[model samples]
Target: MRIQEPYTSERVVLRHQGRDRTFVVVTPLELPEQPPALLYFHGSLQNGNVARNFTGRIFDDMVARTGAVLVYPDGVDRHFNDTRLRLLEKTRELDIDDVGFTRAIVDWLADNRGVDTSRIHACGYSNGGQMVMRLLHDAPGLLAGAATFAATMPAADNRVEGLGTVSVPTPFLAMHGTADRIVKYDGGVAGLDAAHSRGVLVSALESARYFATANGLGDPDHETVHGPEGVTVDSWSREGLPTVELWSIDGMGHVVPTPKQLPASIGPGTDSVVASDVLARFFGWA
Candidate 1:
């Protein structure tokens, strides 16, 4: 199938909580049976299409090449109610069930949009990434695999007691740049300038370890890939269980990685490795 460049964008509306929720659907001209569905959450202060723009053709190409349906759900007021006690200025004041909002997308696509239930996947970047963690905790069964960028597991202090573990084995991939000041690659307090958020965060490594353990993987084997200068990919896996990989890039920042050479000013963006590409590969959609 010849996938078109620059995916088709469509706005979808669903009524939730006495309000109308909107999202953008980016897909190829053709819709395949049981095609993979990627429901992506936008970062704080970004709408669905805005989020789509940030990821660029990484998503457009994914839909074309893999025949996947990409859904970019808009957050309440451009920010998600993630797992944070102190959210950004625009986010800390609102109460929203993003999980329900996201689940509605899954159901909508499956029932109305021809999405394959067995091949559903979820991923997020920035604040959206944190939301993905919540889904893994709240609704792992809704996805075949999950990926996150610039977000980590909320620190133990951030999550309320009674958090549960997952019995399902959904593959997960987390990629972050070491120099991301907004979200902090080291996993500290997030939601500074945008959200005015305050809270300690678990490191990326800790988040990956937590998922590996929950997936029933024991004793992870670690390896650091030698890649282009300023990029380091650290991966962990075990005898069995879905794969979990964490990519750490040096001098990278809060931008969705693209497969194009970027200037140092943009946190060393590069086409050498795109997060969306890795995400599709993790789900075997590429």
Candidate 2:
């Protein structure tokens, strides 16, 4: 079965935190017995609408292959109140209960839609990825795994309060380009457009190690590959299953890591691997 292009959301009106919250969901035309769900979040300035097609139709294969329900959530004011405490504008201005919102979305899906609670997973880009990290932090039991691109944990100075101590040992997949200027792979000050700096972001490799430590893993086996040249993968696992993994795409930028053609506005991409495929394999749904 194939997911139709230009997917429309079956709206779920979740009354939480004293407001009517909304999210877009696209389930398979034929829902299997307790299928997994892939809930996606958008970046700093994007909404659910844009995330559905941000990577140039990658979700098409993801949803179809996994046979999982696909969801996109709109962040408050088009931004997820992630770890960064001092972000300018509405992202930091509003008191958003994004963690609660994520939990509520998962509960609604399990109770009403019969989605398998065990296999549920999420992936996001930039700010969206940070939201997923928050999910991994707070609601690990709800999500089996997650993948993040172009974002990572904030530096110690930039972090406000991120689950202090996490509850679940979340399996994570992190991908970032070595050339990402927006959220520098080396960490530290970056910006939203030219107006404001997002403060210090933790380096991508460090972020992976952080998660590895959280998951109780030892030093990761690191290797440099040139599938597309300059990209390296640092992997942590037990037996065969990947507990945590990081993909560093060399010479790439702050964009969805894909080989497909995207507009220049979205930034450069690589053909070394398809993100959806990687996530599917990571989540054990492929």
Candidate 3:
């Protein structure tokens, strides 16, 4: 499919596994910019189209403030788990080529957007968070920093076969809602939850701590942002690699809320904490 580049959005189709996968690039129409660029993966219920179409005003504000470009990619129904009672499985296999895709994206951005490739970062929401964790763990040298909102680490049973070890350790940030019901803040109710309960836990933030410790980042920076609406933003990170930040919304249901947009039913603002801003802060791009 010949994807049209939206107003400011550019299109690049990657041929992976003999299938043409589409990734949308949005940012300044220049290349080799010394500013930071982000490679983002969207959560469940958010397809590439939705991710490409939905432009958060807060995100725009962040870009205006930090000059960071946002690149949103698509994830399949892709199941990363082979345990009993699996959630959703990818239509195809896990897009292992995503690493190559991301590498291409970063290279393309560097060549076309003038972005500082060394400072490139990765982030995702929900399942995107899971994807980011897998990418960082499997291909550590690819990102300088990576963060997630409402995501978890991959299960050992779901490990990609023949994936090599990570040489350059990347700092990471894992964000989640303590009260999340969808991807459960503690993994999941039946799926990841069982894994975590059985010590297969992959809470995004939890993984960061473990990885940081193994990577020799002891006692890293930890902070919490508490608001009146019972929403608490928890962030954790270490120097170098990629920083991981987790925003655990207390008493909030699934899905990060845009205070100024959408309704409260699907879960609205938990207070003044904006998911987009939190994401930006974690990335250090803001």
Candidate 4:
């Protein structure tokens, strides 16, 4: 039987330090007796309306395939940084306490929806991917696994409070595009316009490997081959403290392939690999 996209909605706000932040929550119209939940973080971009609209589309498409409950959390207007975009200097501002905000969202979901806390997973794209890494290090016990697509480290100094290198690493899947013009896998120009223009690149794979290794995952096993849509797919996986993997979609761009479901701004020629599928696999979903 062909699966259907579930009943989903937006504007479910959770509280953290008296702040009410928005999230796009979606679930299969009819879920299993006990199923995993996925909490998603959107990439670095404008906050408010832009985030809501963009994430809504992505979540709708992803849930269609995996049927997992999905949440798209919003970030502050600029980033973890201030107006200047200076990583180190911006640390002091820290307008959006993302870690606390995320936990609040998760807690709210478990209590209100009766979600299995242990089966909860996290996934994000680009800047959102960077947030996942921070959460992995800060709240190691919170997630079953985490997946990040085409994201790189925000800044070394953006560490979560009270987390050390010895923290248990979370299972992860990191994906990038090789032909990416922005945020080149090789650490090229880091800009929203550029990174979003193309897909993951070589430097991106290596950077992802660094995180896997740091988390106690062994060296990543690389996979590069031709995939659907006449595009090359490069990927890697690792094992150890926090098992992890990375995918570098060669010749692809930044947008998640959603067939006809995606907005025109995201473009076509992308694959239908489904981000939720990768997350489900990483979390060991049945």
The TM-scores of all predictions, comma-separated, are 0.89, 0.90, 0.75, 0.75
Give residue 160's lDDT in candidate 1 (0 to 100).
32
Candidate 2 per-residue lDDT over residues 1-286, each given as its tens digit: 9855543347677898888777888866666789889988888778876776677667755786567888888887888877776567575677788888888898888887798888888999998888888777766577888899999888777875555555678789998988787888898877755677877888898888888878777764444344435667788877654488898887778888766676665457787777888888888878
Which pairs of residues clash in candidate 2, taking residues 3 or more apart in a chain or in different chains?
226-229
Q: TM-score for candidate 3, please give it.
A: 0.75
Candidate 3, residues 1-286: lDDT per residue as tens digits? 9864322566677666576766676665343258788776775557555653443545544564667777776654532222212334553245345666667777777777778878888777666766676666566777877776655655556444554544566666655556665555665342334443322345545655665654555554667677446655454455553443455667555555455554444443355477667667666655
Best by lDDT: 2
What is the overall TM-score of model 4 with all chains considered together?
0.75
> Total clashes, candidate 2?
1
Q: Which residues of candidate 3, in runs, are more than 4 Å off?
A: 1-7, 29-32, 52-57, 76-88, 91-96, 155-167, 190-201, 219-244, 260-269
Evaluation by TM-score, superior candidate among 2 and 4: 2
lDDT-superior candidate, 2 or 4: 2
Write candidate 4's Cα lDDT for 10-31 as tens digits: 5686666666667767766666
**lDDT of prediction 2:** 0.78
Which regions in candidate 4 have their CA more than 4 angstroms from the true location? 1-5, 46-58, 61-67, 78-94, 154-166, 193-202, 220-242, 260-269
lDDT of 4: 0.59
Which stretches in model 2 have alpha-carbon errors above 4 Å?
A: 1-9, 220-230, 240-242, 263-266
Reference-based TM-score, model 2: 0.90
